[model samples]
Target: MAERSFHVARLPGFATMAVAVFVALYLPIFTLVAYSFNASNSMAVWGGFSLDWYAKAWANEQVKDATVRSLVIACFAAVISTAVATMAALGTTRRRAFKGQTFIYVMINQPLMVPEIVTAVALMILFGLVKTVTGIHGLGYLVLAHAAFCVPFAYLPIRARLEGMDLTLETAAADLYATPWATFRRVTLPLLAPGMVAGAMLAFVISLDDVVITEFVKSGGQDTLPTYMLGQLRRQLTPEINAVSTMLLAVTVVLLTTFFLLTRKKD
Candidate 1:
């Protein structure tokens, strides 16, 4: 006789609760996206659909400048943080029976353990002092601060990838008289490329979307997109801001989806 399969029914209350949670989470996002197409400047009152705000946002010179600066900071910080994290992950994972290994790991991840506001305040104080002495003012400070903040985000994925990696291939390479550099370059690197790419993307998104650290660390006129958006919201309310927000939302969703797909479990 064939085995019988039983289907389980989902509870009505559970389904209703799940729908309520989704609505609470996504209703605002849907509203924001809808208003991005609003013809009128008012956020609350919709005056039919139009693409005028998007065109205006594109034409804004400050928006262009802020976006370029943001991308520049994100790119440099992502590269620096990802490189540092890859090294840190390798050091912690490849070594055995080391003293204070756990402590070292925790130290590397301190940025994540501490609140962003605290880190921003501390960085603001430190950078202010450095600026007073060095007379430096520009994107350099923002890049450094972002790199420090993004290190832990980049570290986790790389470390997980290293941990999940099979050692049989590496051991075989050693048995075949491959040098450490050769083994790493030929065997390990090829296998670990996906994780490194994922880490770099993660770092880039984190740095790009950061407002607290960027706002705190930036000098006068050095507004990234988030900071610029905040300034716009503070001074005036307009659909142009909504247009820009929509673009940022789209970019973030695409990058985060890619990150999610890359980090998903594979058999």
Candidate 2:
């Protein structure tokens, strides 16, 4: 009975801790979202509610351009990174271990192990050389940089799915004279789709929010949404920033909710 009372006494502490954690994580988000409708420019005063900030954010040419650039970069990064990482996952997990296989795996996943700033600096130096050699300046450099960062993110879950998969069915298919390409196309690919989708979404989010590499590799006039937000911060804190932040938060919420629903285990 004494021990039971002690446990009961601790329950409130645990509950309080959990609530504290949730509040700590979400209170800032809630404040940002709430401030999006603030009539006043200053965040301190409520100044009643208004949607003018949303309108202003929408009408802002710089915001529109940056948002579009971010979307394009994320889309390209997601598709290309997913494709390459899926292939790498399949090859690494499905094949028998051979000489230098470990090295290949390490090399493929080096981006995750290295610091982002280091990667950004390396890409800056490399692309500088390329630009000097070819004289072409475009968004391709940003796309490639983002893709390099996203590869390890995409590789992890796909490789796990591949490794956890049962090989007996694949062996049976082989025994029945199924071609390697056909067996993979019909069986392995279908099973691996969930992991691939999850990884791609992760890559998209990473690319969307990346400011460091984008700041480093991007040339003049190519501001992504995050970089645009940084630029705005330098000028002043306005409801416009809040409104844009709210939109980004909504997008993140939608993506995560959709991903959860899509990837949830079916009955």
Please provide, for model 1 over 109-139, each residue's C-alpha lDDT reduced to its tens digit, 9 standing for 90 to 100. Answer: 9999999999999999999999999997878
Q: For candidate 2, which ten residues in a row score worst on lDDT?
A: 3-12
Candidate No. with top lDDT: 1
Residue 157 in model 1: shift from native, Å? 1.0
lDDT value, residue 182 of candidate 1: 96
State the lDDT of candidate 2 residue by residue for 87-206, as single tens digits: 999888887888999899999999888898998999999999999999999999999999989999888877877887899879888888989988998888998899898878878888
